[model samples]
Target: MQMASTPTTGDRFRQLIRSLTGISLPPSKVQMIDQRLRRRVVEYGLPDTEAYLEKLLAGELPQDELPRVIDLITTNTTSFFRESEHFDFLTGHILPDRLAKARAEGRKRFKLWSAASSEGAEAFTAAMVLEEARRKGAGFDYAILGTDISARMLERATAAIYADEQLTTVPRDLVTRYFLRADDPSMAGKARIVPELRARTRFRHLNLMDKSYAVDRDVDVIFLRNVLIYFDATDKEQVVDRLAGHIAKGGYLLVGHAESMIVRHPLLRQVKPTIFQKC
Candidate 1:
C-alpha cells in the first residue's frame, strides 16, 4: 500500500483555524500565529509548530487543549472607555431616549449586551455610566450581559480587576466611585470594580459564529465592538442578521468605529458612523 502524503504546515494551520473559529487567517498573519502559539507549543512539550499542529489535527490531544488554543488565538485587547464617543452617545442620547420610551410604556428595566466583551472593561464601563445616570435622577433599572468566545477572558472579566494604566481614560471621580484599590502590596497599581457595579453585570461564554444565539430578545443596546474585523463578509452579514433578531424594535447596535458595512440590512439603519438602529 502507498503511504499517505503529509499536509504542509500552512495548510494544516489554515484548516485548523477555519474549522474551529470560522476565521480565515491570511498569509500575513502566519507570523502572528507563530508568535501567539509558541508558548503553547512549548507548554505541551511539542518540538515545533509542526508537532503541535500534528497533535491538534490528529485528535490525540486532551479535550481541553482545543479551548486553550482558541483562547490563545482570540484577541482580547480592550480598555475602560476605550472608545469614549460610544459611551458618550450611549449616555447622552441612547439611554435617555430609551428611558423615556420605557417609562411611557410602564417598563422600568433596560438591558445592554456587550456581545464581544473581553476582560469586562466595556461592560463595567457601561455599568458605571448607567449608575451615574441613575445618580443624576434617571428613574430606570439596568442590567448588563457580557459575552466572549474565550473562557479565559470571561474569567478575567468576572474577576473585574485591572491594572491602573488600564483605567487612565476613566474620569477620576468615576474611578473613585466605582473602583476599589487592591489591599495587598503585591497587587499595587491594581483596582477592582466595586461589587455594586459588578452586581449589575454578568459574563458568559459565547461564540458569534454559532448557529443560534442564546440571549434575551429584548436587549436595548448591544456593543459588538472591535470584533467583526476577524470575520469575512459572509460571517459578518450572518452575525448581523442573527443579532438583529435579538434586538427589540428601535434598539441600537454599536460596532467598532473602524468597521463599515457595504450592504445594509432592511431592519437596521445606520444612524451614525458605527451605530445602527433597529426598525
Candidate 2:
C-alpha cells in the first residue's frame, strides 16, 4: 500500500537544473541524479531520494543547498594537456605566430583561457609549455586564466596540488621541471605545481550560461573542450557564440575532438576539425 511519488518533482528538478546551468539532464540520468544526491539525502536524514527531491523542488531546503548540489552534479573531467594536439598546435603555430605579431606591434603578453578548466590542470599545463617556450628564448610573456562553475573545483585548482596518479599523463621531464614534491608527509603521494608555473596561472568561478563572462575580450586562445556535449542544441549554439565574442580577431578556439561539429557560429571559421579562428 505504499504510494508512488509525484512525477512533477523529477521534471521540476530537470527544469531547474537546465535553468541554472544549461545542462540538459535527461530521464535516463535518474540513477545518476540519485547517486550524486545520495549523500545530500543522507545528510538531511531524508527517507530516500524522492523525499530529498521533493524538498529541493518545494524550496524546503536551505538556500545554500543548490550550489552544493551543482558542485556535485556538474562533471569535471580535465587533466594536464588532456588533448596533446592542442598544445602541439600552440607551440608549432599559435604561440610563435602570435609572438611574432605581438613583437611587430610592440605588445608583450600572450593570454590564454581554459574556459572549462576543472582543477587547474589545463591552465598549469599551458603555463608549463609557455615557460618552456620562454626558456627557449621565445621572448614573450604569457598568462593563463582557467574558469569553471564548480566552487569545489576552483578551490582545488587554486591549491595547485595533484596526486601521483593524476600526473601519469605528464612526461617525466616536464614533471621534474614543473612540479615540486609535496613537503608534508600526509601529502606524500601528491605534488604541487611549481611557483614559477603557478605564478602565471589563475582560476576563477564562471558559468557559461551567464549573459556575459568577466574574461578578457582579446584572449589569444581559448580551450573550450569536452563541455559542449552536455548542452542541448540551443544552449550549445549560444555558449559557442558567446565564447566566440571573447576571442581576439584571428585568434583560435579549440573544442573537444568530439565537439568539433558544434562550433559553426558565423563569427568563427573552421581551420582544423576541432580548431576555429575568429573572423
Candidate 3:
C-alpha cells in the first residue's frame, strides 16, 4: 500500500494563508501566526490549531470565516497623520501645483487614493489637507478613496470614529474643523470625523494581488504606504506595475519611508525618498 504524506502544521497554515490572502508568512513567523490565530481558533470552537487547519485545508470552513481569519492575521497598525511629511508635501507643493494647472486647463476635480488605507485615518487626513487647500483658494473639488484587504478594518473605517490618542499628530485647528467630539459620556476620549469630510471620502475592499484594480483609472495621487513590506519583491513589482496603469499622466505615488527599498517600476521615477512620479 502507498503511504500518503501529511503536511506539517506550519506548512498547512502557510499554504492556506497564501491561498486566501496572497500574504506569504515565513516559517520563522510560525509563532506570530499561532498567536494571531489563537482567538479565531477559540472563536470557532476548534480544539486546537490542528483542527482549525484541517477545516481550513479541507474547505469546510464557512466562507465568511476567511475574512475574519484575514482580519486576525493582518496587521492594521495606523494612525491619523501617521506620516506627516507626506501630508505636508501634498498640501504644500503637489496640490497647489496640480490645482493651478487644473485651473488653467479648466479641469476642476481632483482624485486621491489611499490604496492601503487602514481604518480610514490616512484617507481622512488627506481629505483634511485637501479641504484646507480648498479653504485657502485652491478652487478644485476633490474626492478621496480608501481601500484595504480587511473587511473588519473597512467597517471600522466606514464608521469614521477614532480614539483620542490617534490624533496626536493632527493639528488643533484641523481637528476642530474636521472632527466632532463624541457626545456619549461612555465614548469619552473618542471623536468622529465630521460629515463633510466623510462626504468627500469613500472606502472599498481591495486585494493588491488581483490581476486588475477595481478603482477609478485616472487618480491624481495614490498613497500606497506601509503595506508593501508584506509583499515579496515579485509581488511588489506586479502591484506597482498594475497601479501605474491606473494613475493619470504625471500623477504621484507615495509609499511609507520604510518601504523605499522595494519601490521600483520602469514607468515611475523616484521624486523623493518615499515618493514616486509617473512618467
- Across residues 1-279, which tens digit of lDDT does each residue of candidate 2 receive? 999877678888999999999889999999999999999999999999889988988899999999999999899988888889899898889998788878888889999999989888888888888888899888888989999989999999999989999999998999999889957897899999988888889999899999999888999999999889989999999999899888988789999989998888888989899999888
Instruction: State the displacement of the C-alpha of residue 50, model 3, in Å, after optimal TM-score superposition.
Output: 2.1
Better of 2 and 3 by TM-score: 2
TM-score of each: 0.95, 0.96, 0.94
What candidate 1 gets wrong by more than 4 Å, as runs, is 1-7
Name the Cα RMSD for model 1. 2.9
Per-candidate clashes, comma-separated: 0, 0, 0
**RMSD after CA superposition, every candidate:** 2.9, 3.3, 2.5
Ranking 1 against 3 by TM-score, winner: 1
Off by over 4 Å in 2: 1-7
Question: What is the lDDT ranking, best to worst?
Answer: 2, 1, 3
Q: Which TM-score value belongs to model 3?
A: 0.94
The lDDT, on a scale of 0 to 1, for candidate 2 is: 0.90
lDDT per residue as tens, model 1, 57-130 = 88878899889888988889999898889999999999988888888888889999999998999999999999
